[model samples]
Each structure stands twice: as C-alpha cells, then as structure tokens.
Target: MVRALLSRARDMLDGIPHRWGSAAIASSSASGHGAEDAVAGYVRMLGAGVRPDAYTFPSLLKAVARGAAAAAEVGGAVHAHVVKFGMESSAHAASSLIVMYAAMGDAAAARALLEACPGATGGAPPPVMWNALISGHNRSGRFDLSCRSFADMVRAGAMATPVTYVSVISACGKGKDLLLGMQVHKRVVGCGMFPDLRVGNALVDMYAECGDMDAALVLFEGMLVRSMASWTSVISGLVRSGQVDRARELFDHMPERDTVAWTVMIDGYVRVGRFREALETFRRMQFCKARADEFTMVSVITACAQLGAQETGEWARIYMGRVGIKMDIFVGNVLIDMYSKCGSIERALDVFGDMHNKDKFTWTAIILGLAVNGRGKEAIDMFYRMLKASLIPDEVTFIGVLTACTHTGLVDKGREFFLCMTEVYNISPTVVHYGCLIDVLGRAGKLKEALHTIDEMPMRPNSTIWGTLLAACRVHGNSVIGELAAERLLELDPDNSTAYILLSNMYAKSNRWKDVQRIRQVIMEKGIKKEPGCSMIEMNGIIHEFLAADRSHPMSKEIYSKLETVLIDLWNAGYVPDVTEVFVEVTEEEKQKVLYWHSEKLAIAFALLTSESNVTIRIVKNLRMCLDCHNAIKLISKLYGRKVIVRDRTRFHHFRHGSCSCKDYW
Candidate 1:
C-alpha cells in the first residue's frame, strides 16, 4: 500500500507544472520530514525537466533558510540560478534569498542581495524585505548592524511591524544597551504595538538582561498572555539578579515547564551556591518524567561539583553515556571539574583524556583540577602541552598555572609566568592573579616580597589580596606584617569579621591581650558576627552537615564517642594541642576543649565511625582548618593507617602517615 502511494506521488510530481511544483515544495518545506528532504525532491523535479519559474526560486530559497549547515552550498547554487533567470529583482525572491544567505552564515551575500532589491535606488525596499535584512544581521551576530538597519528602515519611511520590534529589541538585549532598549520600548508603546506576545517577551528579556529586574517584573505581571519563553526569560533574569527564592516561586507557579525551564532553575540554584537544593530540583524533574537534555545535565553536574557529591556526580556521568547523550565540550569540562572538586583527580583526568575536542575551558578545568589536587607539576606540564597545541592561554589559564606554581613552591616558575602573562601574552593581571602570587610568596615565607608585590601592584588591591597576605602572616607567625594586612583589609571591608578574628588571634599568639580585646570590642560595636564554621561529608548520595560543637545529627553519640577514641590515639601518637592558635582568654584546658569540637573534626569523626576502614575519608570545611585540628588529623591518620582528604576554604590537604600535602605551609 505504501509503495502504491509512493508511485502515485511520483506520477503526480512528473505531471505538475513548475508553478504547482513550487507550491508543493513550499508545502513540503513547511510540513514534510525536513527542508533538506523537500529541497531534494525539488531538485528531483528539476531533473525531470520541469522548467524553473520565478515562483520556484522563492521556495528553493525558503528551503535553504530552513536547512542549516547542509543548506549553504545549496543556497549558493540557488543564488546562481536566480542570477541566470534574472529573478534576483523579484522582491519576494530577493527577500527569501537574503534570509537564506543570512541563515547560511553568509552575511556578505545577504547584504548584496538586500542592496539589489528592485526598489534599491530612491525608495526603501518593502518592510518585509527590511525585516529580513534586520533578522539576517541578527542571526549573523552583527547586532550593531541589525540595530542600524532598524534606524535605516524608519528613516526610509518603511512601516515597522511587531516582528521588526522583536528583532531590534533582541539586539538591544545582546548589546546590553538598556538605553536603546528603553527607546525601542517607547516606540513599541507609541505605535500601539505593545503587549504583542513576542515583542513583550523580548522587552522583558531586554530589561532583565540589563539588570533592571523591577521593570522586567512589572512588565511580566502586566502581560495578559505569557509563553513558556516569557516565563523562562523572567526566571533567568530573576536568578541573575540574585533573587533565587523569587525565581523558585515563579518556577513553581509556571503552568507548564519545559527542559529549558528546569535547567534554568537548576542552574540558578548552583549559581547561588545552593547545590543540595539544585540536586533536589533535578530529582523532582526526573520524577515528573521531564526528559533531561545537555543543559540540564551540565547544571546538575555543576551542582554536584560544588557539593562534592562524588557518588551522584559519577552516576550522572554514567547515566549520560547510558542515555546516549553526547559528551559535548560543555558536559565534558564540567565533568572534569566535578570529579576534580570531588577529590577524584584520576577520574577527572580520565574524562579529560576521553574528550574528543578540547577548548581552552577544557584545558583550564583539567589544569585547575590537577592544581587543586596538589598535582602542581602535572598542571604545569599540561599548560605547556596546551601551548604546544597552539592554543593561546587566556586569563583563566594563567590563574590555574599560577595557582599550581603556588601549591608546589615553584617561586621562580611563578615569577616567570607572571611576567610572561603581561609581557608576552599581553594579558593584564586581574586582582585574582595578584592574590595567587601573594599567596605563593606568603607560603614561601617571603613576607617582605609579598608585601612589596602588593605595593607595586598596578591597580589598587582588593580585600582578597590583603586577606590572603594576612592569612599567610597568621600561618607563619609574622605578627608585624599580619597587623598591617589586617588594618588594610579592615579599611577596605570594615565589616569583615574574619579579618577581625584573624587579627585578634595574631595578637593573642603574642600575649597581646589588650590588643585582642580591642579588636573583639570593635567586632561587637560593629555587630560583625563571625561566620560559623561548617563541615560537610557526602555518603550514599546524601550530604551531612555539621557545625562547631554540633549535636544535631542522629548519630551524634556515636560520632562523639569515635572522636574521643581518635583523640586518645592522637595523644598516644604525641600530638600536642596548639593552644597558641586559639584566641580565647580561657584556660589552656578550655582552649583544648574548644579546639576538639571543631566542625571538621566532628565530620571526620562521623565519617570514620560510619565508613569502612581502609577507605579515604573526605571532609569539606567552610573555614581554614585550625592548626590544632590539622595536627590532630595528621596524627589520627598515622595512627589509624587511614588517608584523610580535607578541602578547606583555600586549598586541599591530604593527610597520611602524620604528614600533610601542604607540608604545614597552608
């Protein structure tokens, strides 16, 4: 029966005139399997000697516009045919050809066609023709030209339609020109063309992209009709504005949700450092049977990276393969980052090796992963390898390389790369780069050079640079430089409780009790509360959080009991509590008690108690690990013959056999 229908279709095609065949091609291009297939059928009709007409070229051009990469050569061929038939002057054919050339990424050809329109001399082309030109430029990413064409159209007395405003407003958003966007919005309102679904949605996106969320929200609420695109735009804008809770509310109220909406929400959560919530929303998306795409998976993987949810991250990577999702560069890079952040550097390397294509981001992720995992030499080698491949290093690439140098105490290499960045690569060092260099000098105990580097910085140092220097001072017991760094940091960020606390601790270490008391009083006067220390551990796809002296966990008793046992072994291994690192005015015993209940210690205790022996224990801490806890963990690892990996606020520490990867430098 299918063969009979096919035969009849061919018979009809053989008898149809060129005009009828053109109409059939248009119909097929709009509703058939795809434009390429329809175009192929049209070519078959040509092979059967059906004479091409003026109507025939437009349909062929339309097919070229619909077909993406495969249509470029076909479009050129059609343009040649139009020239041969003298049909290029036909307004419809010219406009269709312009759109086709633009869709094929040939902006030059599209412009030439626009200029060749029949009304090109004194009068402007038709509005439809101008709209095609504007849209073509927009598609080619020449937004500036797109906006210029809009002005040209207006000056030529061409009537702008809702479609024109939509394209122009989108260009405004891309260029981040809120002023021009508002001008366009005014025009839209003045023409009584406001509130068109497409136009209104573009306006919302423009306002949102320009950081005017209030205006976006107002417009969104006033719109009588909203599409899924509108909701997604507003939701993403709200997320970018740091209103995650409001974004979530809107997302929950969305009448319909698509894959893009789900991905936006998940990405929003990840952006705000709410990884667990991101994962929860992802699970809900799966429960609702919303098919996850590449974007959704990238967001989910990023959330796992931040949370150090290695098990779930690995499962996501495996699931991508099982579901036949192509491991594109984006997914591949994030996977490397996820495994690296989860302390699985080997797995990160594996992913890196498996990627078929590697961009700068791909190299940067793996380099940073190796750097953070304390494989600094390997990171440096990878940077050279990237250079050998003729890939120019960007700012982020330098950051990873500088960080690797700092981690490995390669001071000379760090200096060379620092100079090479500005002198050879011509990449101006951002404050972050300076911070990394400061950390390198500070770690190497070159306190004077670190301070000098700050003085010689081309730009004013930020709070992070000063804070990094102060941290190094605290680490090396250089109270003089520590005092200077603290003062500068406080001046820059007056309400920074970490600076106050660190300054007070430095003073206490030298028995300068009065100075310590003054800082504490200042903290109280300013109401600057210190951020509570927190530590987290992931087990069996669940993350457990603990705070200093926390007893909220269901297994608190067992955790505390295990902590006590570990303390005994640590003491037996000759571990001494570094009371000087504690800033409290209490007695030494009380100081020891305070130190024992640190959040990371509690997390480690819980992990040791619950997990099987011989497995590496991983802990993530929100604050820098205390000296006493660091020493205790080192001893505990030696005593129990276990390896403990801790990711503190600044860097990673792998403790084994009474030694730390940081070599007591951090």
Candidate 2:
C-alpha cells in the first residue's frame, strides 16, 4: 500500500509544476507511510533504470522530511543514493538532508552535514546553506545551537539573511533569553534588514513571551505593517500578564478583527472578572456577524455563567446548533454549568441528558449543579448513577454530595457521607470537606458540635469555616457563638469586611438595632466595605441590574410602580414585611419602605412588568438574598402566578406557588 501510494505520488509529481511538487510530496508523505517503505519504493524506481539528477534528490528528500519520525529515518537510505548519483556536494540536496535530520530531532547529524559539505569552501558555508542548518536546529528546539550557528556564520564572514534573524528570534521565545533576542534585533537593524514582516512578528512574539510587553508594543507601533498574528500575540501576552485593560484597548484599535481577536478580548475580560464587559463584547461580536468558533462560544458562555445570563446562554446554544457546531463533552459540560448557575436546573438536566459523551467532569458538574439548585436527593441519585457508570467519585464529587446534604438540612446524611469519603473511598478529607461537615452541624443548630468538629480538624480552620459558623449563628440567633465566630474571623483575618457584615446581619435578625449600629460604625472606622447587594435579571436579550434602592434603570418608573402594586397585593394576601432584618437607623415605616426597594425586588418588579405570564423570571444576586426579599418574592410569585428563580451568592431559591425549593432551610 505504501509503495503504491508513493508510486502514484511520484508519477503525479512528474506531471505537476516544480513549484507545486514539494506540496504534493508533503501531501503524500503525511499519510504516515513507513520511512523504510518509502525508500524501498524509491530504490525500485531507480532500479528500473531511471536516470536521476542532483535536483531529483532534493524533492525526494523533501518528501521524506515532511513525514513523521519513522519517515525521517529514510533520509539515510536516500543519502546513499545521493552519494551514488555523485550529488552529495549539491548544496540544495545537503540543505534538504539537514532538514530531514532536524525533523527527526538529530541536530548533531544536521550540523555535521553542514561542516562536511564540499560546497563549504574556505570552511565558510553560504548564507542559504547556513540558514537551513540554523532553522533546522530551531525546529529541533536546540535553540542555543541555532544562536551559536548564527554567530559562527557571521564570524566566518558569511552574510546573514532576514531568515537567519527570524529563526534565532523564534528560539528565544521558548528559551526566554530576552537579551540574546534584543541583540539579534540590533544585529538585524545594523544589517539594514529590520522590520521584515516575518522577523518583526517573531520579535514581537519573543518579547511577549519573555514578559516584555512594553518593548513588544513599542516595536509593533514602529512596524510599517502588522498582521493579525502580530496583534494577537501582543493582546494575548497582555491578558496573561494581568493587563487585560491594555489588551482590550488594543482589541478596540485593531484595524480588522478576526474570530480569535474577538474571543481573546471576551476571555480577557472574563479572566479579569469584568463579566459584563465580556458579555457586551459578545453582543458586539454578534452585531458584527463575525463567526464564532468553539473557543469563542466557550468564553462567551462562561461569561453568561458568571453573570447568570440564562437567556444569553440559551441563545448561544441555539447559535451553535444553527452553525452546525455539534455539542461535544466540553461544550456540554459548560452548558450544564451555565444553566445550573442561572437557576435553570431543568435546562441543565436537558443538556446532561442530550450529551452522548459523559466524562467524570460531566457527571460531577451536574451533581454539583443539582446540589446547588436545592435538588439534594436528585444530586445523590446522580452520584449513584455516576458510580453505576463505572466512574469512581473523586473529592469534588464528595463535596457535591456533602453540599447536597447541607442545602437540605440532612445532618445525619451529611455525617455519613463525610465518613464514607474517608473510609470507603479512602479520600483523605481536606479543609473544605471538614468545613462542609462543620456547616452541616452548624445548620442543624448543634453549635457546640460544630465547634468540636473544628477543634478536631487536622488543619487550622480557615475563614470559610468560621464564616460558616457565623452564618449559622445568624440563622439560629445564637449571639454567644456568633461573638466567638466574629472574634475568630477577626483573629484569622482582621481586614475581612464579611465578618462585620455577617455580625450586623445576625444582630439585625434579633432586632438589636443598637448592636447593628455599633457594627456598622466599626465597619466604617476600619474602612471595611462589603460589596453592596445587587441583583441582575435578563429579559429580551438585555441584562438589567439594580442595587439597593436603585432607580437607575431606563424602566425605573415602571419597575417602581409595578413593585408598589405587587407589594399592595401581597399585603392583601397577608404578607407582612419581615422587618427584623432592616438594618438602617430608621423608623418602622421607613424600614418597610426600604425593604420594599431592595435590589431583588426592583429586578423582580422589572420582570413582572415586562415578562409574559408563566415565564420563569431568573434573577442573580451578588450577595445572599435578604430575608425580606425572599419572603416578598415568594408572595409575588404566588400573587402573579409566575415561576421565580433567584440564584443568590450560594444556591438557588426557586419560588413557585408561594414556596421555595429550599423549603426555608437555606
């Protein structure tokens, strides 16, 4: 089969233009024919009494060099033929042979050919031949040899070409030898060969790889012409260097944007936690009608996950299908996560069910998703399903299992799983596992047991552990344990504003208004500011955000009016304001008003005004949804007959017919 293919390729090469012959050779050799078989076929051709010249050997060796390691070894057998044909002194043949050795990672053999070439008169190889050896060493990743070879060429009074500089500069990117790279740049300019587009690209890539974005940007600006490769290198380097702002700036200034550029910009924003900007960039990408690759959609969907933009994620899913981009395991997993985080567990389930390829990660993502969405039993069921699929559960899977028990207040089940993780699975518990167990005990009102578990921990407790205890303190109104938790938080992390905020929330829950005031004063004195509570809702492809008492939306009037009417109806339905959590130093009436204008309420009101009946209104909150907002949304869902899904900081609260999926346990 190899001989037949090679014979056909040789016959076709004889018929095509010489300029196209190398491409044909490459096309034929890529099929992975054995190196020994290729030589056997060639020898058969020669044995048939065909007279081959010096030029004939270059193309044949070119064919061998294009192949994999097995094919590259045939260079030796082909070299014997070249010697037989008395073409061993041919520079072209020698160059091709050098390339073949380098392709097989035989850098020393390639250099030996250069030194032994009869054409290297006066012990100085010409620039063309030197370039072959230099570039071949580079391809072999013997970059130091490439640089040394370039120096030898110059020292031997041989002129250097732009190709020489290009190859050497490329090696510096991997070697991280920025000084040698800059010296090459100086040499290139001195030779009046600077700014060759290929050399310039290599230089920019080198500097970027070496962590010198400033030099890269400076060189890029001075270039007479720039390609997308140039733009992408600098932008990518900037993103990795944590200067995504500069990357975005360069992205906006790009003369023409390609799919990679757009994707890079969106992902750069996502990496910097500027999720809104990423989504906005995706919007712009859609507006331009530029095509999106799988990578582009991955970044875009991740931004959706971060922002809880379900509608946008669904649109992306539809877009991918319309574009004939099939759902692979990776994309399937991302979609499941996006839906899960957006409080759309049913959609996540749909993605999980439709996926044909299920990796361990796929099962794990769905399990965690179910746990966070208040489907604890379902999550455990999925865990068993994963085990039945012959996939062993890892530590992450156990985290999901424990979290399932945590969200549903299954204290006994949580402890059992913790033990199972250590004994049955032989998975040593990390702090996270212990923290989950501690949270289980804490949530069950076993405050003393929770502390004892912390004391028994092999590792010192982290902020997350104390924070869990503090949160449980707030839940059960245990001022004594809450104080202990707060002191631990201060000792563990003096500057964390979360300790103060959680403390204040606990006091407010108990109607200790003066204590709340004191906590607020301390937070202000320490300049510790917790992020203000904010909620976001997506409707009609637009994401609307609101902060507490926010009136900044374009539909603020309608939202406020709708909220007022809804609250009035709720009050008629026997919904009294849960004023225990109202923290401001205000009168009773003012507190109720403030509660009415909470961020989630505004977002819900906006949805209530615009959405059709029966459409699920999804809201994402930056902080834990407040008590008043949760109770009011439950009533609003009942009063308006809408399914309301709100994903707060920790888990999903799905309100339907005046009940949350969490069953008041969260």
Identify the candidate with maximal TM-score: 1
Candidate 2 has a TM-score of: 0.71
- For candidate 1, which ten residues in a row score worst on lDDT? 1-10
- Name the lDDT value of residue 130 in candidate 2: 81
Q: Per-residue CA lDDT of candidate 1, range 1-666, in tens?
A: 323422433444433345444544554443323565656676686779876777888877776676554445455556656665677678777788887777667776666656545564555567788889888777767788789889988997889999899889998987888999999999999999866999999999999988899999999999999999999999999999999999999999999999999999999999999999999999999899888988999999999888888888988988888887767678999999998887889999999998766778989999999998899999999999998877789999999999999999899899899999999999999999999999889988899999999999999999999999998887787899999999999999988877987787778767788887787667667777657889999887889999989999999999999999988887777888876455455677898988899899999999888888777888888888888888888887888888998988878898999899888877
Best by lDDT: 1
Per-candidate total of colliding backbone pairs: 0, 0
Model 2 lDDT tens row, 208-286 = 9899999998988888999998998899889978999889888889899999899888999999888889989988998
TM-score (C-alpha) between model 1 and the true structure: 0.82
Cα lDDT of all candidates, in order?
A: 0.84, 0.82
Residue range with the least summed lDDT across 10 consecutive positions in model 2:
15-24
Prediction 1 global C-alpha lDDT: 0.84
What candidate 2 gets wrong by more than 4 Å, as runs, is 1-203, 206-211, 222-224, 387-398, 410-434, 456-460, 492-498, 504-530
